[model samples]
Target: MDGPPATPPAPKAPTLGNALHRFANPGRFMRLSGALLPWLAAAGLALSVTGLAWGLVFAPRDWQQGDTVRIMFIHVPAAWMAMGGYVGLAVASFIGLVWRHPLADIAAREIAPVGAVFTAICLITGSLWGKPMWGTWWVWDARLTSVLVLFFLYVGHIALSNAFDDPERAARPAAILALIGAVNLPIIKFSVDWWNTLHQPASVTRLGAPGIHVDILQPLLVTGLGFLFVFAALALLRTRTGILERRARALMAARAAEPAATPSAVAV
Candidate 1:
């Protein structure tokens, strides 16, 4: 009797999750990022220098703010980076939680400290910019409070990620914390409209066209893009270093365990 031919199984459908899975291999990620890093670093440096120089030397001074307006090049871009970096962290955390992707886990770990630095830069620069304009260095304003909370969230994530000797045990909880803290992002962005705060309303990112003049706007945009590129380059660099560190740790642990598994010889 002739047997019926078996049907071949259907191929898996393409998807974002499936696409991201390719980055799970550390070797592949390392090779690709190594090639990409130099370009990002150079672009970031050139753009940042051009923007700061244009803003500081060429941009017309605000009739109201006078020379203090120059600080916008640094302060505004920093605030943007702080919030943007946190969003990236939350996304990486989601990828880590949902897929248990090792690279995502490593990325989440590396991003926290860099995000924290951006948050701190925003706070410090905000204070300095405020001291001259607002007449005080500190305020309990809604936007400021929300941003401070964000800084704490970054600190908490860093603390949690390194709390245990075994990182796998800590990964899920830290990821969950990042997701929870993302609730504050909307609060930070909308704080001006949500409440009467000391901080000004949206200037660059308004639903309507931007309120600022082109002279100020151009430099601001360049600096903002520059900060984003630098942040990406830094995060990728840290992730590559992390992958190498993990490899070293694994080799050392394996060697440490090797001797205990061997039997000792007895002399006759």
Candidate 2:
């Protein structure tokens, strides 16, 4: 008889990459996010508070717009994040479509609503500022119209993503839409120059210098950073909530499938 076949060596213990694989599963993700939630919340709160106080109180008023310019603290940051978030979602959607990472679809799904909300806030706040500054509540200008299209794109993304019962099926078409809409981003940025619109020329970046003075720049930076932190915190929290919800549903289904074994198992 031949000698007993030798067993293969056990695989090396899993690393962080493996942990990430496991984390992609909803249950493990929920645990990790639960642990991280408090820290994220604290950071968001601190950043928002500091930014608001410094921006509203300490930052010098603009020479051109004066007190009316204060709205920039909210409007500019929201506008930036609105565009930034779509780019992020589109990237995540691409990953989901190509690599099929489990968390990628979840990310894409959650980010749409957040992006839409920010876009809406930007539009509203911008309108409020524009009415006084531009002498109109709304204009059919290129910048404004492109931003409107962006808002509608966000709405379409969120609605389409949830329209299907099968998560995998929903992900595929939604991912395609996100990728396509990403093309609109550069269009939005250049629309002001492409057409003579009411929106002002780029003040933050032009030629070799920023037009805004240091005093205004300082609070703008603070508010921008604060908005970034808040975005991160919200995204994390929303993704975690989605993971937990899916896990809980799966657990409930699993429990339902498990038989009771007639009360005798309980008696024993």
Top-scoring candidate (TM-score): 1
lDDT of 2 by residue, 210-239 (tens): 888878877777777777777877887888
- In model 2, the runs with Cα more than 4 Å from the true position are 1-32, 256-268
Q: State the C-alpha lDDT per candidate.
A: 0.92, 0.83
lDDT of 1 at 113: 90
How many clashes (backbone atoms < 3 Å, residues ≥3 apart in a chain or on different chains) does model 1 have? 0
Evaluated at residue 129, the lDDT of candidate 1 is: 88
Give one digit per residue, the lDDT tens place, for model 1 in 1-268: 8789888999999877888897567999999999999999999999999999999999999999998999999989988989999999999999999988878888988988989998999999899889999999999999999999999999999999999998877889999999999999999999999999999999999878899999999999999999999899999999898888889889999898785533444331
**Clash pairs (backbone) in predicted model 1:** none
Predict model 1's lDDT versus the native.
Answer: 0.92
TM-score of each: 0.94, 0.84
- Runs in model 1 lying further than 4 Å from the true structure: 260-268
Model 2: per-residue Cα lDDT at residue 130: 92
